[model samples]
Target chain A: MNDNNSMAYAQSDTAQNESAQSSPVQNNSIYAQSSPVQDSPSYTNMPLLQLNDLCKRYPGMGSYMSVFHMNLIIPRGRIIGLLGPNGCGKTTLIKMINGLLTPTSGSVLINGMAPCPATKKVISYLPERTYLDNGMKVSQMVSYFADFYEDFSTEKAYGMLGALGISSDARLKTLSKGTKEKVQLILVMSRQADLFILDEPIAGVDPAARDYILRTIITNYNPGSTILLSTHLISDIENILDDVIFMKNGSLMLYTSVDSIRSQMGKSVDTYFREVYAC
Target chain B: MLGKLLKYEWRGLRFPFLVMMIVLASTTVLTCSVIYTINPNYNEAIPWYSSMALMFSIFLYYFGLIGCSIGLSLIIVIRFYNTCYTDQGYLTHTLPVTTRQILHAKLIAAFVADVLMVLAIAISLFLIIQVTLHHILSFIPEFTYADLMWEISRGIGEFEEIFGIRIGLYFAYLAIYSLIGTIANIVTLFGCVSLGQLYAKHRIIGAILAYFIVQFILQVLAYFASLPMYARMLGTSYNSDFSFFGLMSPTMNLMLFFSVALAVFMYFANMHMLTKRLNLE
Candidate 1:
């Protein structure tokens, strides 16, 4: 068989094995690649994000690099929780995947394509803090996103806003901190994308608001879309996650399926994260 | 993309732009009144027009200062103020837009605002000239009936003679200059702040100190860098025999090109740091 067919066969085999371990892919996820004209109409399996030998370095005191080489792969249709303490490179990894922070060496592929403007179109991101301009009203902010993103559904965005009881006319500056975070989340979740990288989505919220945010994430996430939710507060999101990627000091310490961790490590993901990252 | 950038830039500066307009309008009215009061026979006096010319000359300096101040303030607001890197960088770097696009948007917006500021001053001058019609006519009765048209033509001639270039070229060069100026400030601001914010060792204080140090070094470099251009503008290249506009045309054009190149260099450096090495928490 040719290179294309061989690659397709290998991909399918990997997907089948992965599916056996996790939830099945759901319909409605935008698939850009075709699987060599499927003869039996079977869905082809593909990883949504693959990080190979990724490295980032910042010059530190007298020639040391702050962040070292690291690697991890995030599969499709699973909530992969990235747990680490302060300065562990969780945010950096997320930023790299979203194309904000580029790797010093190695490569990262989003849906098998190099990070570019086109790849960004399929990645939804909610930053840890409010990034929206404080001067803008909710309506203006909505229109701004709508102008750029073709997949941004204004109707759905407003519906979500209404459901959350947020005023469309309220300026971002006037909103309370929790409310502002919700506004940002609304904007992020509004886009139907293949990958959603939420960097510390619930870090600043109270327990109640954190629960609300978690619920919002679970319900709003498009099926078949991969999610990499990075947070130190693992217990809150532990029940929903299918896998956990633990990082420390700019290195990947552990990457395993949740069930495997429970079966082997014999501890909850939260307990595992705390033990691994505890100071 | 440029248009969107300009739109957002304008959105960001709506308040400042309005304030600039009001300042221009007041200055225009005040200047006209002062000139009329000084020369009651201003309409008949040719020398009275000198004051109007002098006002524009003064405005030229103000334009540069205001442009620089606004650009500096914007840099602080967008890059330095509050000085949190983690949250801000996350949002900024992931906007589904290229780093270059973001830079272009900011540069264009700042340029447009600066241009409008200059225009506000120019428009105010035009209105004053129009309102002082009778006074201008009475002062130079020999050039009456169509003296307004004559003054306009003369003004155009004077601009060409003094600068030794066409008005179109002059305006284009100015636009380029303002754009580059804005880019420079933005780069310096972002680079320093990002460096500070990302460094786990020290944050805002370190960033600010680094910024000042960089600024001082750049200023020293810039002084030497500007020596050739300053000599050109001040030297014999400023031909007194030529029309007012022709006297310094080459120097102005050269300065414009230099600023643009410098700005582009700074722009790339800033983007490189932001995209690759940003230590967003």
Candidate 2:
């Protein structure tokens, strides 16, 4: 497994370098210059998300921050993995990006504008937990999404639901946990959004379901859109990721390409993660 | 977007509200039928069973009427909390709509619900009174619908003459007051809940506390506002040159003005919390 991954990363490394050289503009944004992925010119221009000096602190913690000053930029069309241990501020970062939580300081820009109704229109998010009303049927939920999001595709959502053998008339509460996750994923992926933020999508699911979820994500995402995926199970999603961001103790530890990590560190991302964050 | 939001908000509350309305209507019909059948005459001796039945039907009618009114308001408040603050908030907050739009949609739906509740109660009471009056007058043999109409109009004319104000204008003022009060109530609850979210723990308890605090503040304001009217009435009594309407109108208008101001303040406060200070768990 290690040998196979090394060879794959080696090939991807070459591809990344070639693409970097071919791309014309350089990302001179503050975050891009600070990130380890800065050398990759393919992601230089027109970032989809940029966070400047973002911070979140809880009261009574006496200056202890949950997410300290962080600067980062996510370019379009890249599937980036946000990998960190529990309570390492991965969820906090995602929440800020989705405008679920207000930052203590600094700003987050999506497509060069602050997170607002316009940004929300283009960002598709699937939270880790089930956030749907249980009394609603699958069909009702589809209509709800269609009503709220202009870009939602009812046909695609229904098609996926039918393919999964899930009845549209079934109440959301009656579905199994795995099936519920699938349904939520389907709702999110059905949107023709410019950015997709999935927080711990594969966590707590069986291996079979995990594989299916990953496949669904890979296939359904718009080709030019960016996917910012956060998960603890790094090995399960490492192969699909274009770049990897490592966070710890409320600060970004590293932000680089997955291929760069494997090629330079001489090991799989999962192994390097263990070595770097080992107790 | 606001229209769509309101459509869904009404859809979610329709089930409970419809159930309440149906139950109230049924009770009203049953009560009227019983009253018509009994047709009790005060001069004549009435049977024990008939009196008991009349009392029971009246109780049920009132219970349904009052229950439905309070129940609908409570349902609206709970729905607001559950949809906007709970886990479901993930979907709600992420919608491609501004916080102000969401707030407006809820307030509009709640206002419509309040209006519908008042209409239902009014219609049900009117039906009961009309049926009972018709049945009682059947014994007179000379009474007709025309006589009832004449009597109602005469009563209105007498009231206008005594008060020096049109009866219709009084009712219009009353309706405005009721609508403003309803908006104030809903917005105050929204503001309290928004304030509660500022707490790091026991948020619901915090919300309850906020509600009590708001109610206390409003009560104090109301008492102080009525003090001038109270003092004037006390010093002059009913024999003063100032008419009763002169004394009461100013107080009534002041209260309505205060309520409208409170509603506006609570609205902007709620909006601020939702957009700026929101920290959903």
Candidate 3:
């Protein structure tokens, strides 16, 4: 009985530590999922990224803080999901991580360093919108990525494009929207970097394309690489995610492991998502 | 790394640059051919050198204006200046290069392009002169190379002579004026974009209006300041044996200094606004 009690206490302590590591001042409710982390053997690894007191406010939002005090901890080699509806600050948060948007007042650290050129080198990002010049051919786009990102893999990118049945000679404008999205995913996943931040990777694509994208992401990204994927299509990507973060409005609702959420919610993640995000 | 930056810059500019070169080459050939045809048989004798010089000078004036307005140099410079705050700039700013490095790359590429344009124009003029003018043999009695070369060598023989001081000074004055003008134009463009981008909507309209407003204010201030400076410089020139060079020197220096300072001020203002208040929705 004492051993069991000690194990339970250990599990709670580990869970607390994990939550704390994600974002400073973040407290896990203990009743939420991911309660067994303290009892797990692998509890000491440091988080790859930590968000502290992040916020973003739009004009005429009525309140001072639009996105108020967001904190998150992301571990290495994990597919972390940021699930939210439109205008939930998921895109803003992702942009902040990629250094596209500056935080109002917060710090985000990647591999113990702030988002500098070195950090950027290890973080491959796929923006929600198409950022590439539409006139460029796929080959030119690849060459451009090759120029800017030292860690980018041209051969791997080409291989991924080939697997996706995308032609390197195809102009970005000429490709269908779904094909363009797939091309973006292929380019992003081809990088052998430490972190991958994919915003709405499968939002506009069809189910088949989305499935192919998820599979491609699983196969192409290095095993040790961390991916932070933000999307509203939670039901489709739930199977591949190791962890899930639910965001409502501009604040975090819940962050827990997939297995733990499954056990606690006593249903598939889709059902839990519907229940949690129900209007 | 600089080479890579330049390579990308050139890649972005290659189509425009190629077209500009083709246009310049064609225009140069056409103008020279027309002039030669108009004065047919003149090349068989000693050519009317002064008349040809005047015609060439007139061609150069239009050429310079056209080149400045629509050439690759202007296109690239304007685009470079605009890139700091355009929608396309979201990619540019996120590149691994430093903000200063980006600025330096744009400026250096622009300067290089400008130099190339100047070289092209110079070569075109040389070719026109070579093709249309009478042979040196035909002009031997009237204008010997030895005499011409001696005329150029006169200033070196006697220090007091200073035979071409006015010409040298005029070139210097014109160069300074052109440099200031180019810098001012680029800075104004940057300032407009930066200020315009700070707004949430109607950014392009705001930018255009802000640019005109700034220019109008500067012109008013310059006009007031120039009254005194002009009076002093002209007064000095009138008293000094019509030494327009000496009088204009101070005025040119002041304008150049003012223009440079304005450009630098606008550049910093733009950079500061961008670094802090950039509202990239």
RMSD (CA, Å), each prediction: 9.4, 7.4, 7.3
- Tell me what TM-score chain A of model 1 achieves: 0.81
| Residue A100, model 3, lDDT | 61
For model 3, how does the per-residue alpha-carbon lDDT over A127-178 read when each residue is reduced to its tens digit? 7776666667999989988888887889999988887778999999999988
lDDT of 2 at B155: 93
Worst 10 residues of 1 chain B by lDDT: B75-84
Task: State the lDDT of candidate 2 residue by residue for B1-281, as single tens digits.
Answer: 99999998898888898999899889998898788768556677777788888899999998898899889988887888888888888888999999988898988898898889889999999999888888888777787878988998899879866665788887887888888888888888788887777675987888888889877877887887788778778866756755566668777777777777877887888888888777767
Give stretches of model 2 more than 4 Å off: A1-45, B142-145
lDDT of 2 by residue, A1-279 (tens): 122222222332232123322222112122233343454454645568888778787666676667766777777778999987788789888889998888899888898888899999999999987888888899999999999999999999999999889999999999998889899999999999999999999988999989988999998977788899999899999999988887766666566787776665577889878865666
The DockQ for candidate 3, computed on C-alphas, is 0.29
TM-score of each: 0.72, 0.90, 0.80
Better of 1 and 3 by DockQ: 1
Clashing pairs in 3: A11-A38, A11-A39, A22-A72, A22-A73
Residue B106 displacement (Å), model 3? 2.3
TM-score of chain B of each: 0.58, 0.92, 0.71
| CA deviation > 4 Å runs, candidate 3 | A1-46, A58-64, B40-68, B71-74, B77-90, B125-184, B233-238
Between prediction 1 and prediction 3, the one with superior lDDT is 3
Best by lDDT: 2
**CAPRI category for model 3:** acceptable
Tens-place lDDT digits, model 1, residues B1-281:
55664576567676766765665566666656655654546255646566666577457535744754565366434533332254655555566677677666665665556566556656776776675776656766677757667777889877866666778888887776666666665555655655565546776776777678766766666666666555655665655354444444445455545555544655555666566655665
Please report, as a residue range, the 10-residue window in candidate 2 chain A with the lowest summed lDDT. Answer: A21-30
Error of 3 at A107 (Å): 1.9
